[model samples]
Target chain A: DVKVTQSSRYLVKRTGEKVFLECVQDMDHENMFWYRQDPGLGLRLIYFSYDVKMKEKGDIPEGYSVSREKKERFSLILESASTNQTSMYLCASSPGQGVVGELFFGEGSRLTVL
Target chain B: GESVGLHLPTLSVQEGDNSIINCAYSNSASDYFIWYKQESGKGPQFIIDIRSNMDKRQGQRVTVLLNKTVKHLSLQIAATQPGDSAVYFCADGNQGGKLIFGQGTELSVKP
Candidate 1:
């Protein structure tokens, strides 16, 4: 069984506070992704990394950034959190050599911005 | 424009009955499609997948039907149970290495 672990399950931040969400995968997957899931919008990709130090913007990349300093670890950062940024964040990883888009996802981190 | 969308936002069915969820895609280049189930407070889980070469595929109690003519996709669940209640999303794996997901349809099962 592959495990994608998220560092935080719940978080609360002020409107201007900086936020960080960390994720790690044990499967040596080369592809990692950050997505925000909302009630009506479903899951919108914020950023994705195919290799360490390499990042690409997804559909919704504004107000967010990502870092992949190590192969197994990918982090999502909110420079200045806002009330509209409050949502469930999900981290996912997939093998670079396997099926194109079969992703293994973490349990998700719920963030609330006041 | 590339978009994957659902026909319905919610579906309710009685336990032990069959349930169907529908999805539509606008990109013709999309060859691979997937269905995912997301429970409350959890990330989406892959339920089934189908390639463009084939129109129908089946899992344990789930079946996926694809219609390229209309760019339509459907998931059918047999003998639906309470445990099957969740939000279902369809995704297209045609954009290079990324997947574009739909809005998702919430399924509720009545006991």
Candidate 2:
């Protein structure tokens, strides 16, 4: 089974604070994604990485950035958290070889910005 | 503008009954479809997937039907149990590896 582990299950941060969420995949998948889930809007893509040192902006990437410094790890950075940034963060990974968007997700990190 | 949407936001069913969740996609270029289940305080889990070439696919207690003509997708759950109560999302994907997910439908099972 594919295991995508998240660094924090729950986090509370003050407004204007920088936040970091880490994810690691044991399957060594080449494609990693960061998404934020909210009510009604569903899971909106924030960023995705196809390989180390490579990243692409998703639909909603204004307040976020990502780093794939290693094959097994991808990190999402919130430059400065705001109240609107409070949401559930999900990390997912898939094989870059031939897979077509079939992703295995982490347990998720719930972020609360005060 | 590519978008995926669900016809119903919520669906209620009794235990041991069958449940159907529907979704519609606007992009004809999409060639892949997937269904995901998300429980409270958890990430979405992959339930099933189908390609454009196939019209129907079945899993353990689930079946996926695709209608390319209408650009529609449906997930059918058999013998719906309390465990099946969760938010379900349908996603449209292509060979390029981009996925557009629907808003999701919340399923509730009553005993």
Candidate 3:
């Protein structure tokens, strides 16, 4: 079984504060993704990394950025958190194998920006 | 921009009944599709997947059907259980690993 772990299960921050959310995967998958889930709109991609030190912006990457410093670790950074950024954040990883596009996801981090 | 969307936002079914969730994708270039189940306050979990080459694939208790001509996908759960109650999402994967997710359908299993 593959395991993906997020640094925090729940977090609260004030407006304009910088926030960092970390994700680690035990499977050493080559693909990592960050997504924010909101009511009505569903899950929207924020950023994704195909390899270490490489990242691509997803559909909703306006106020967020990501880092893939190591193969097993990926981080999502919010330069300036706002109330609108409060949402459930999810991290997922998939193997480099082309055949399987399945994503194993970690327990999401619920962020509340006040 | 390409988008994936569900026909219904919510579906209710009995515990012993079969559940069908439908999704539509706009990207004809998408070659891979996956169904995900997400419990309240948790990340989405992979349920099943199907490639463009195949029309159907079955997992433990779930089956995924894809129609490339209409760009539609459906997930069918046999003998739905209380544990099957969750928000279900369908995603399209292109050449790269990036997935475009659809607005999820919330399934409520009635006892």
Candidate 4:
């Protein structure tokens, strides 16, 4: 079974603070994604990386960035956290190339900005 | 311009009954669809997937049906149980591998 590990299960931060959510996948999947899940809004993609040091902006990428320095690890950075940014963040990974749709996801990190 | 939405926000069913969750998508160009189940405090897990060309696919006790004509998709879970209580989301994927997820339908199974 594939395992996606998230560094934090819950986090609390003040406004204007910087935050980092880390994710690591055991399988050698080439595609990694970061998404935010909110009530009534569903899951919206924040950023995705297809390869090491390569990243692409998703639908909602403002105030967020990602770093993929290695194959197993991917990180999401919130440059300046705000109250509006309080939400559950999810990390997922999938195999590279082909019509890949099945994504293995890690336990999400719930961030609360005060 | 592209969106996926659920017809019902919540559904409640008795144990051992069948459950159906409906989803609609606006993008006709979507090549495939996937169903994900998310339990409380956990991320969404892949349940099943169906290609656009195929209308129905079954896995374990779950079945996924896709209708291109109406741009609709549905997941049918037979014999609902307490473990099946979770938020179910249908996502549409394009060739680029980007998925547009629906505002999930919460299924509550009464035991």
Per-candidate DockQ vs. reference? 0.68, 0.71, 0.62, 0.75
Q: Candidate 2 residues A4-97, lDDT tens each?
A: 9999999999999999999999997989989999989988989988888999888999989998899999999999999999999999999974
Q: Residue A72, candidate 2: how far off, in angstroms?
A: 0.6
Q: List model 2 lDDT by residue over B16-106, tens digit each.
A: 9999999999989888899999998788899999999999999999999999999999999999999999999999887257677899999
Better model by DockQ: candidate 3 vs candidate 4:
4
The sequence of per-residue lDDT tens digits that candidate 1 reaches over residues B1-111 is 689999999999999999999999999989999999999888889999999999999999999999999999999999999999999999999876788899999999999
lDDT of 4 at A88: 97
User: What's the lDDT for residue A56 in model 2?
Assistant: 86
Clash list (residue pairs), candidate 4 = none
Error of 1 at A81 (Å): 0.8
Best by DockQ: 4
Is model 4 an incorrect, acceptable, medium or high docking prediction? medium
Residue A71, model 3: Cα distance from true site in angstroms: 1.2
Tell me the tens digit of each residue's lDDT in model 4 across A16-51. 999999999999999999999999999999999888
Candidate 3: segments with Cα more than 4 A from true spot: A97-100
Q: lDDT scores for all predictions?
A: 0.94, 0.92, 0.91, 0.93
- Looking only at chain B, model 2 earns a TM-score of 0.97
Total residue pair clashes for candidate 3: 0
- Compared with the true structure, what per-residue lDDT tens digits does model 3 show for residues A1-114? 999999999999999999999999999799898999888898898998888999988899999999899999999999999999999999999998433488999999999999
**Top-lDDT structure, candidate number:** 1
TM-score of 2: 0.97
- Total clashes in model 1, counting residue pairs 3 or more apart in sequence or in different chains: 0
Cα error of candidate 1 at position A59, Å: 0.9
Q: Candidate 3, TM-score vs. the true structure?
A: 0.95
